[model samples]
Target: MTTGIGQEREKNMEYDLGAEVAEWMLSQTGAPDGARSTTTLMGLQWDVFPGVWHPNPGTRLFTSWLPIADGCRLLEVGCAAGVTCVVAARGGCTRVVGVDIYPAATDNTRRNAARHGVAGRVEALTSDLFAELDEDDVFDVICSNPPLVKAPESRRIDTATEQMVYDPGYELHRRFFREVGPHLADDGRIYMLTSETLADPAELRKLAAEAGFTGRVHASEAIGIPAPVMGSTPAVVAAADEHGVVRVDFTMLEFQRG
Candidate 1:
């Protein structure tokens, strides 16, 4: 087990500048509760600053491989700081929409869209999963960094960014996979991030089947220590024990309509 104040430092050594600042802000409160996440991501300078959550490694990695196509309709569920939406607009997606449960996220997305001069093509809305989207409206590309990390259930969610990390019963995963297909055009693709070791492959396939879609691991990479979010939950602990170490995989999954 990697247990040491020194080990924590070692883990942080791998994070980029913005992520490091965001992590520090998460660990602080009181006066620092006002700390803001940087707008810069993956070297793409942003016109507006981040309001609440910072972009994670999964979001950064996934944006690098986003398939570019002209006039494609793109949607980002759980858009935190609007990074994916901005990235899509920058990549020339004709219509881009960002939906999040948080008002802060929607505001940030729209503001950033304008800041990027893509306001005409990009829009943001606050929605509970797919509740706010019309059934007739479909997307050619849908992506998200859902709350896939399973931690010991906490009645109180910490920070907005923490919202992306903790999913008690994996409810977000179930709902996203079960309902996402309807809003996805027949030719659309779904991109998302989930824990490599924690996500159940069979269960994911089953969820996709129920939604009339197919899911597969498009890419995955080992990430820094997951100790921060790897609470004392039995299953998580057991997996860590079984591995003889605690390692996290930042995986990108692709889903397609059947």
Candidate 2:
């Protein structure tokens, strides 16, 4: 559902300009191309130059933690456009399941998997988190770049591309940590990406600990905004400061389950 906002995010860029710019960059052609030229992760070549949101830096950063053992079952939460799924499959994962709330995103992901010649190894489904997933199912690895924006009550939906800006707050993140454990194999691990805007290393650690899982911060990067002038708003700045240090766009966070 459209959360009282206009049909297009551009109309309200003044409210969340950084998110707007991020959306715009994803629409561009350069981002994805850049990803392709950069590095090969999990045997998949990414297109990051044209942008388009595939191979999101956060997702790529988290992929490093994925064990490359062949025949491993991997699940990608919020798989947008399926690029990460392709990477996992190419990396020799026996099975890869991509779950998202947006049907179009899942469709795109499916198509992309076919294009990469890994459709047989990758499956994309439209579901809200683990709702549609079988509780007994287990995975060797899990990865996600969840919605971590802190916006007003006006923005909240299940679209994969839409900016959450808020809604899936810190509590939801904690819930994710708690719920993921049961779906993991004995030696399974999780790789999650978040920003300082939602929560910090300490917060995620606390959540994992409470869930009876050992966790560690694998990597972190300062949230860098390419066009701060276009997307920086007072609300965004203030919301970012609430968690940790506020920067331009987002502070990339990687959480590993041990």
Candidate 3:
């Protein structure tokens, strides 16, 4: 039996611990000015900038799994350094558009596309979700590996880099589902990646349903998180086992109009 006062205290402690571990995970990224680094994926050289959402296991996995067909138009939301954008263009996608809220990320995407000689087929734009996209713009395949954390009000996110990690109240995701349909062509599909270690996939599906979209888990694979941060993050604690091994799963969810 717990009193209301005791429950409040426990909640506060959880928030504090989650914040502490979140800061540690972010520090590992060399963020804010993720000074230029390069990595090879999908057989192409891509320059990674830290201020943007640089390629992580989630991004890499999403890129490889996206269904990009020859001559299909593709749009990638939160297209951090354009890993998927470049791959789509080189994979024979007729047009690839990558949008990010950070100008630096969009710039980085442009640079990488040009680096791989796919600039002619790739366009990078600085847009907050679908805000900057033209109403008539439609894509055959729309994909996003969005921020997985449902940031609580206790956490302070002051930079674009922080925005890449925390989606406060899931406002960004709500906006995505509500606005995405118009941008998708007929017979098109949406691909979004979620992680059990970061957020609730069920909640995401609920949001999609509220927006009149049907979603299903298209793929799922277990992945590991750094062991040390497991206990402090309350949101992801249930994802770990008795041995303190984090049993995280990266789930790819597909959506279409109901």
Candidate 4:
């Protein structure tokens, strides 16, 4: 009888561990704040939280420049949880489609959109960008905050695998530009953001030109970490000296479809 009881306890413990692992995975994707969230951005009340894609600083820059009028169709690629989708909906876009490789992320987006009463205005899908999208499906605006950082060789996955977030290479941005042109309406525009470390402005502009896009620099900013607090390594100090800046610089490139 004691042996049977011990076996039952072990099973219970295993069940608990499995539950914990599931919860942790969910948290890593994004933490939902119940069904809704209230956040303050630039002194304005904004809705955001877990299951919603958190707008990175680059997204914010593009959002600020958006021509928020009725009847605009917006597409956001790599939209994890759809924070930017909600923002676009709130900004008066008639239709917003957010695509990601992860079904859970899209599911989060759907829930968050419903929470904000914008579910009708937003659609989240698991798609490989152009793969699932109809050839003729075009948008007024397209935006993305792609995973631009290259992973170390040891952790690299098969190149042929379709992932929601994976580093293709420095030239992935070039390919994105090439592919986007065909899907953009004549008057359509694209807002893309990536770090200087990942892509240079000149190279991006050239790629856009090849893709039949007229590119312009919309905004640039230096992301800084306090030097004293960031212990000085030789490389860090050298970078600071060269740029006369201790901050990582980022540029927002806007492309207009001609």
Using TM-score as the measure, which candidate wins? Answer: 3
lDDT of 2 by residue, 159-215 (tens): 433442233446556667767877788877777665543334566667777777776
* Candidate number of the best lDDT: 3
State the lDDT of candidate 4 residue by residue for 1-258, as single tens digits.
559889997655543432332222233333343454555543344544445444444456556655556889999887765667887898799889988866656876787688678999999988876566878888998888775443333545532221223354545666678777667778888987755543345766777788778888777776553433334443344445443445555566788965
lDDT for model 2, please. Answer: 0.62
Give the TM-score of each candidate: 0.73, 0.66, 0.83, 0.67
Whole-model lDDT per candidate: 0.67, 0.62, 0.81, 0.63
Q: Higher lDDT: candidate 1 or 2? A: 1
Model 1 Cα lDDT, one tens digit per residue, 1-258: 667987876444423222332344354322224544444677765433344565656568777766757888998888766778887888889888889987877887887777778888888889988889988889998888776544444535766656655565566677888778678888789987765454444665677678778888888876554433634333334434343444556677788877
Model 3: how far residue 98 lies from native, Å = 0.4
Error of 3 at 253 (Å): 0.5
User: Which digits, one per residue and each the tens of the lDDT, describe model 3 over residues 19-99?
Assistant: 554565566455664477887666667787767665766677898888878989999998888889999998999989999
**Candidate 2, residue 243: lDDT:** 45
How high is the lDDT of residue 75 in model 2? 89
- The list of candidate 3 runs beyond 4 A from truth reads 1-25, 225-245
Please report how far candidate 4 places residue 144 from its true position, in Å: 1.2
For residue 167, model 1's alpha carbon misses the true position, in angstroms, by: 1.5
- By summed lDDT, which 10 consecutive residues of candidate 3 come out lowest? 230-239
- How far does residue 258 in candidate 2 sit from its true spot (Å)? 7.8
2 or 3, greater by TM-score? 3
